[model samples]
Target: MNCEQIRELLAGYQDGELDGAQHEMVSGHLEECADCRAELAQLDKVKEVTGKVKYNDLPLEVWEGYWQGIYRRIERGLGWIFASVGAVIMLITGAYYLVKDYFMDPAVALFPKIGVGALIIGGGFLLVSVGRERIFAHNRDRYKEVQR
Candidate 1:
């Protein structure tokens, strides 16, 4: 195997994932290639160090405390959800009357005025979007010319 092939297989070889034939090929290559040998040595050192490192074990009391914290958060989250639902119901009820009193009335009204204002704002936004697109396209063409 070439150096690149050996390097690609080196990680799997170190992890004992290679078959016997593949292992032999890598071993043969490592023997002949100084670079692959050095790489394998480095991988072996990393595996050795990682294998020797110790992990801290959590106690049962710690696990209980973690669950307690999670339960408290869940309770608080549920409370917020209920409060938000209540607020939304209140807003819908309040808005119903306000909209009826202000807009649905056939007398001197604000609905047509608000509708015209919204149309004007929407038109302005459309113009701004088109202008931005044109500006970006022009800048992009200039940048391409500079790159060339």
Candidate 2:
């Protein structure tokens, strides 16, 4: 097996999840690859230490307090998100009216100039949004492949 495939299977091999043949293959690879052997040794040490560590249970009041803090943070985060969305809506609405007024004014000789400026700004925003979406999609695809 290749080094990457061996690395990916290391966790399963350590956990005894691999079939006998696959386990043997990984073992063979580890015997030949110093880096993989080092990685496996490190993982084994981590697992051993973690397994030996003791966990403490929180008191009822402490649990409640922990949950309360989490709840408060979530509430604050949601409130901020809503407020940001409202602000964006207001800005867009106000800008729409301003643009409309600029274009409707009969004596304004700079209507075309203002319209062109608005168009350029709007186009730039659209391009940025599209670019961001494409980048997010590409990264998401890569993440899924890695998970597999």
Candidate 3:
């Protein structure tokens, strides 16, 4: 067999997938061709090491429940998102009306108005600080790129 044919069939020969005629032809070529023999040797060593490698096998039930677990987590996440959005909307609406009324009322005390303004500013600063911290933490998370 020529070098091109031998190279094409090399993997099949190594895996014992070649028929009797093809196997004999490849064997004869390997005996006379030093390059093909060396290549075959490398392929054999790789196959030997890979063959000895073992995989961790989980139970059948674990595999069956895997999708269910993922689905439940996604469901819970969506529910929490909806609930949180609704709560934020209500809080923002309430705060907007309260602040509007406070500012519009000329009879309201100045000290109380200042206190309310300080509280709003403090809450905004806290929210921004927490959001920035969370973004930095997520960027630094080592397993963030890992597949679930």
lDDT of predicted model 3: 0.84
Looking at model 2, report the run of 10 residues with the lowest lDDT sum.
Answer: 52-61
Against the reference, the lDDT scores of all candidates come to 0.80, 0.83, 0.84
Better of 1 and 2 by lDDT: 2
Give the least accurate 10-residue stretch of model 3, judged by summed lDDT. Answer: 52-61
The best candidate in terms of lDDT:
3
What's the ranking of the predictions by lDDT, best on top? 3, 2, 1
User: What is candidate 2's local distance difference test score?
Assistant: 0.83
lDDT of 2 by residue, 3-101 (tens): 999999998999999999999999999999999999899999988877655322336666887789689769967986898699779878976876687
Candidate 2 matches the true fold with a TM-score of 0.36
TM-score of 3: 0.45
Return the top candidate by TM-score: 3
- Per-residue alpha-carbon lDDT of model 3 for 1-148, expressed as tens digits? 6898898999999989999999999999999999999999999998877765522234655666777768876996798689879979987998888878886688999999999889988998998899799768856662563444
Per-residue lDDT, model 1, residue 15, is: 91
